[model samples]
Target: MPSPYTVIEIFMTQYRCKRERNARKKFSNVF
Candidate 1:
């Protein structure tokens, strides 16, 4: 059984993780 909310949750989590990683790299370079 598949749920629509599950897919959205996974996608959002991946997007957030990617954004966080990029931000970390940007701040690290600045520091």
Candidate 2:
């Protein structure tokens, strides 16, 4: 099994990627 910190890190990375994707979509829409 993975450690708690490792799991949290994975979750954070996924969340960051999602946020970046949304930001990119919004930026493209504005242009």
Candidate 3:
């Protein structure tokens, strides 16, 4: 099984990707 730290890192990466996608969508709307 994966360690807790590894699981947290994975979640953080996913959250970051989601945030970036939302930012891109917002920029596209403005432009």
Candidate 4:
């Protein structure tokens, strides 16, 4: 089984990916 830390790390990476996508979308609208 995976450790707790590993699960948290995965979740964080996904969250950052989503944030980056949103930022890009907002930027495109401005430009």
Candidate 5:
């Protein structure tokens, strides 16, 4: 089993990845 901090970090990374993908899509639309 993973530690609490590790699980939180993993979730954060996934959230960041999703945010980055959305940002890229928005940026592409601007140009």
Candidate 6:
């Protein structure tokens, strides 16, 4: 299995991508 840190890093990247996508949608709606 992967190390704990590796798992966290992957989770963080996916989470960040999702959050950025959501933020973009909100910004587009506002503009």
Estimated TM-score for each candidate? 0.87, 0.96, 0.94, 0.91, 0.88, 0.92
Across residues 1-31, which tens digit of lDDT does each residue of candidate 2 receive? 9999999999999999999999999999999
Cα displacement (angstroms), candidate 3, residue 10, comes to 0.1
- Cα lDDT tens digits for candidate 1, 1-31: 5699999999999999999999999999998
Q: Write candidate 5's Cα lDDT for 4-28 as tens digits.
A: 9999999999999999999999999
Model 3 gets an lDDT of 1.00
Backbone clashes, each candidate: 0, 0, 0, 0, 0, 0
Candidate 3 wrong stretches, greater than 4 Å: none
Per-residue lDDT value at 27 in model 3: 98
lDDT of 4 by residue, 1-31 (tens): 8999999999999999999999999999999
The residue-by-residue lDDT of candidate 6 on 1-31, one tens digit each, is 9999999999999999999999999999999
Off by over 4 Å in 5: none
Q: For each candidate, C-alpha RMSD in Å?
A: 1.0, 0.3, 0.4, 0.5, 0.5, 0.4
TM-score of 6: 0.92
Q: Report the number of the highest-TM-score candidate.
A: 2
Worst 10 residues of 3 by lDDT: 22-31
lDDT minimum window of 10 residues, candidate 4: 1-10
lDDT of each: 0.96, 1.00, 1.00, 0.99, 1.00, 1.00
Q: How big is the positional error of residue 2 in model 3, measured in Å on the Cα after superposition?
A: 0.5
